[model samples]
Target: MSNTVVNSAGAGLVRAVPALVGAAGFALVYLVSGSISSAFASSPAPQPNVSGEETRAWLIENATASAVQAVLMLVSVAFLALFVGAVAAITRSADGPARRWAIAAGTAAVASMIISAVLSLLVGGLAAGLTPDAVVALRTANFIAGGTAHVALFGLFALAASRIPGMSRPVRIFAIVVAVIAVGSLASLAIYYASILILAGRLLGMVWCVFAAISLARRLKQFPPA
Candidate 1:
């Protein structure tokens, strides 16, 4: 390849650095949030079908922690959004289905976060004023948005990344698996025990992001300008 092509590829890799950082940030912040919330809790948080009074008391008692968790989630979502946009740019520069797939993935990724984001703000900022019944309702909605729905839509990103023409076999296969786990997590909506799928998809998606970003950088470096 010519020096010009090499330089272009190098520039692409540099531009991709944000996506790498964003992916890492998304995972790290989310982990920290979970850890902090768990650390402060005296008992396991209430689940769906728990009494509204019990849920309300739990929220009120943990109001500060809930706010902190919400703030962290917002930050993580911002990082994930950055990752989606940056990766989409990289895919758009490549040939084949990558471009279209990335766009769809990016769209889904952002859309998935909207409900979670809005609900987070409400839970964090308005928990004190919420009725017991409202607490139960919001809590369920929060779980659905941040848990199942988020990962289900995020699976599209993994699926799209898997299609990038020159991605390594392992990364592509892993991305596909992550996508399946993530998209399949939708089953949890009906079969409550299947929430394990949501957990797997959410956590594995982070790992996939890191690997995919590295693979994307490597692929960009290897390919020359047409």
Candidate 2:
């Protein structure tokens, strides 16, 4: 097999590991939190006679889910690192529009990772003092930074992946859709549901990441080690 194929395969494998892991983490957090929210909505409002212990217990229970979300957040950062590494490795073969996009995507990945780390640190510091308003403010910032990064990185990935030889047409089309979604999500940031839109965009972005990894892996397998 050729060097191109080998490189692509390695990149793909590296990329896939984090994506699958992150997706699992995301699913776990989503399910747990959504369930809790549903339960809370269905339950009766607190009675005037309710004890302090009961309230504390409720908070503790919610905290458990929050802890799970924190773990998922860290896993997501790991995935971003893997994505950046894969893009760096594959960018060498890219030229023209593809090369430019790779560079931009790699840079955005790095920025996104950095911002995520910062947000995590901030949340940890404020965890004890967290109120609904404070959480909303922090989450707003996180969504803005995260959404911008996703748009930049995914847009680049779509452009670069579309140019790669042997990549399937469907993968290219998916990339295009991801790029469009990212842009639209960014535009929607001015609205109250920005977080929701951004989350949706990131989910779509994950699909593109998986496609990229598979394509790169297939290329790599076609090329053997020298």
Candidate 3:
């Protein structure tokens, strides 16, 4: 094979790294940490209301599990941040709509990370000490930061990516699908089935992360750095 072909393959593999990391992060959070948290929730110690007393009791009962899950989630956020950065880097040189959309997506990703960090830290560290109002505030922030901003931001990013010239049909569709699912996170606002909807959205979004990671990996393997 020609030198060009060899270089292209190498590049494609390199590109896949961010996607891989993102996928792993998702698995860690939604799958592994999720399982742990689920156990806690199922236990009798868990309560539905967002009260300081309940928070303290739950924390006391599931302290180890909660802490572990929080750490895992925090790591996942870091990986996701990396994923966003990688995507932005890939699109940084583009002009026009692609550029605008990619920029929006990256900015949104950063903001989402900031919000997630705060939420995760609070859950992991200060659960026992929070006031009732603080607990309520966290829930409100979770909806906007986690549900609204996160999905909407990523959706905009996907919109931009899907329009990039010469982008593959599969990848474009994948972005669109992921963005829509993420936007579904807003279902967190609902009273009856909020957790179910949010979880579903997040699980669906995992498809994007895994697929994107594989695609980037393939691209890195096939292409050369400019």
Candidate maximizing lDDT: 1
Q: Tens-digit lDDT track for model 3 on 1-226?
A: 6999888666656666775876677556657766766565535434334565676666556666655655666676677677766765654444467856766775675577567656755764676677656755664564467556666566666557556654567878877776766666566566635555555555556666677667656554223343
Off by over 4 Å in 1: 1-12, 39-43, 95-98, 222-226
What is the overall TM-score of model 3 with all chains considered together?
0.74
RMSD of each: 2.9, 7.5, 3.6
Clashes of 1: 0
Indicate whether candidate 2 or candidate 3 has the larger lDDT: 3
| Ranking of candidates on lDDT, top first | 1, 3, 2
List candidate 2 segments past 4 Å from native: 1-68, 95-97, 127-137, 194-196, 221-226
Model 1: per-residue lDDT, tens digit, 1-226? 6999988767777877987988898889888887887766666677766888887787777766676677778888888888887776666547577757766776766666667767866865676788877877887898888888889878877877677776689987897899899999999889988999998998999998888777777776544444
lDDT of 2 at 215: 61
For candidate 3, the per-residue lDDT at 90 reads 59
* Runs of candidate 3 exceeding 4 Å displacement: 1-4, 36-52, 190-195, 219-226
The TM-score measured for candidate 2 stands at: 0.60
Error of 2 at 94 (Å): 3.8
On the 0 to 100 scale, the lDDT of residue 177 in model 1 is 90
Better of 2 and 3 by TM-score: 3
